[model samples]
Target: MAATDRAEYCGIGIRGVAIGIDSFVWFALLFVAITVTGVVTGQVETGAQGVHTSLSGTPGSIALGLWVVLTLGYHALCEWRFGKTIGKALVNIRVASTDGSAPSLGAALIRNVARLVDWLPSLYLVGIAGMVLSDRRQRLGDRLAGTTVVSD
Candidate 1:
């Protein structure tokens, strides 16, 4: 294979850093969204009932739903449109198909969806193990989606 055709996978340390950056970004977004929502709705009740009301089904469910959308949308759109999230860009990495091209929306969606599996038992232990074990340094999501994260 030509040097150009030989894929160079990104290492775990850098990938971890990229993920850290994305996590920080996600946290900021969630904080802002929740704050704005609370201010606009004035949903906070007073006294002991306040906590209960805030944690009750509707508001809590709405928050959860919004979080899921924001998180998944962020990953899916970024991967599809740019092959990289802001964090991935900052880290000089990108996601691409096995043949080394921009991934399709289906591939992006599959990877992001499979992220749930990679996240099993918390802190992405399964993903970490997969990346460590895989020849292309793929996490479970990447493997399932037939994609890999590589240095750009």
Candidate 2:
């Protein structure tokens, strides 16, 4: 790819904003599912009693597990199928290896798996700092996976 195809920054700021938006949406969906389940179960309670209640019901566990599945599984599937997330699509950006090709499954998994570390210590400061400091705008995960986020 031509140098002009790249930007001085990898657009992590924009990606962060997109992630915030997605998180809000996911939270809303999860809340709705939880609410619906509670209503159907007729298990609604009031005040601090509700707070003390445990979500140990099988249905509740399944719903919670599905939420987790949706979050991680969706990202993996989207990266494999479209080379980006919905946010990346909106910004016309994609994640690829430094070689300017789609990242391999191993690379993608490695980068995503390292997200736990990138998100360490609070608010993804480490990841954000790495993106800002690196000449290629790569976060720690990107560096580890030999990947880069680029605009199409």
Off by over 4 Å in 1: 1-5, 32-56
Error (Å) of candidate 2 at residue 140 is 1.3
**Candidate 2's C-alpha lDDT?**
0.71
- Displacement of residue 83 (Cα, Å) in model 2 is 1.3
C-alpha lDDT values of all predictions? 0.82, 0.71
In model 2, the clashing pairs are: none
Task: Give candidate 1's whole-model lDDT.
Answer: 0.82
Each model's TM-score, in the order given? 0.83, 0.69
Per-residue CA lDDT of model 1 for 1-152, tens digit only, reads 52215867986898889989999878976765565555556765567544322444665666666776788788988999999999999999999898888989999999998887888989988899999999889999899888999888
Find the candidate with the highest TM-score and give its number: 1
Model 2 lDDT tens row, 25-90: 578657766665666666556685453223556868866866665566556566666778777777
Off by over 4 Å in 2: 1-9, 28-69
